[model samples]
Target: MSTSAGQPPYRDAEESVGDLVKHASEQISQLMRQELRLAQAEMRQKGKRFGRGGGLLGGAGVVGFVALLAAVTTAIVALDLVWPLWLSALVVTAALLLLAALLGLVGKKQVGKATPATPEQAIHSIKADVAEIKERARR
Candidate 1:
């Protein structure tokens, strides 16, 4: 029988089945590649955002350190009348050091939690797709 437009030509069942499997495999592979690329792009964007955030946090830490120094100096001048100047400076210096250490620890943890650059999700997706293709082909 003549095939109409938008219709597949009649063929043996085996042939039709093989063609279907081939087409599906090709489409799945294409989709898998696209997904991998998308994952890479997303990871890169996330890395950039994390870097920018880290930079901002570092800047804030520097500003805070400077402010702490200024405050300590001012307090030492004003309190020298009632307290030992050396004691005031020591206390302020210790507090500023502790604050710096705490900020460093927090920033380290934040950066550690950021998403990895590897396309793990895409890798998993492609693996699953391959298994499905294999299973279908076997049938």
Candidate 2:
């Protein structure tokens, strides 16, 4: 049977059930592939960001360690000029301990705020697509 010019022949209500099912299966497969590609691309982008961030943090740690060493040395030397060497060393040690404790507390608080890391954007997109498909299917 022929269909109107505005309608596709394959989409006609009179189309065979097997043809309709096959068409739907193909569409679903295409949608799944698209979603998978999106997720892969998203993950790859996130991986790059994580790699760069880790490298930057590592560099910062080295720089901070060197700076901390110099600062401690300066503190001890400056104190020793006015006080005994042993007392200067003790004071510097106490100050470093206090600074470390403060940093530990702040780091703990920040860590508490961290979410269970996942590909949140990809998950959300996939969920939305599923919801849309479900809504359409309901029709």
Candidate 3:
């Protein structure tokens, strides 16, 4: 007998218990693999965010050091000469400090965003899937 046009050949009117169990196993395995992939992608994204935050923080530190040096130079120049050069150095130092502050704030925000970097969505999905499986099994 030929199956209907809308149906596949393997999906008959009735399936054996073993076939059902095997299909369920395959489905569960596929689900696990998908969850794993999701978790890995999430972790990689979090890692990148963390790396960006760390780089920004390092830049802030370097800028802060430059600002310190500029301040010291400004003081020394002000003592040596009575001109606008000291004032210019002071302005540069202020600008560097502002830039460093901005970088530090942005880096802190990035790090905060990436904190507790767990695969939250994947975990929720897996939990929901398990709950659904349990509910179905009760029937």
- Predicted model with the maximum lDDT: 2
True lDDT of residue 62, candidate 2: 100
TM-score of each: 0.64, 0.77, 0.59
Report model 2's TM-score to 2 decimal places: 0.77
Better structure of 1 and 3 per TM-score: 1
- lDDT of every model, 2 decimals: 0.79, 0.86, 0.83
Candidate with best TM-score: 2
Q: RMSD, model 2, all Cα superposed?
A: 4.9
Ranking by lDDT: 2, 3, 1
Query: How many clashing pairs does model 2 include?
Result: 0
1 or 2, greater by lDDT: 2
Model 2 C-alpha lDDT versus the unseen true structure: 0.86
**Candidate 1: segments with Cα more than 4 A from true spot:** 1-15, 115-139
Q: lDDT at 137 for candidate 1?
A: 75
Better of 1 and 2 by TM-score: 2
- lDDT tens string, model 1, 23-101? 8878987887797787888789878987898899899989987997788788778777777988777776788789789
Q: Please give, for residues 1-139, the per-residue lDDT of candidate 2 as tens digits.
A: 7679867686654777778779988988998888788888887997898789889999999999999999999999999999999999999999999999999999899768765656677788879978987898798
Superior by TM-score: candidate 2 or candidate 3: 2
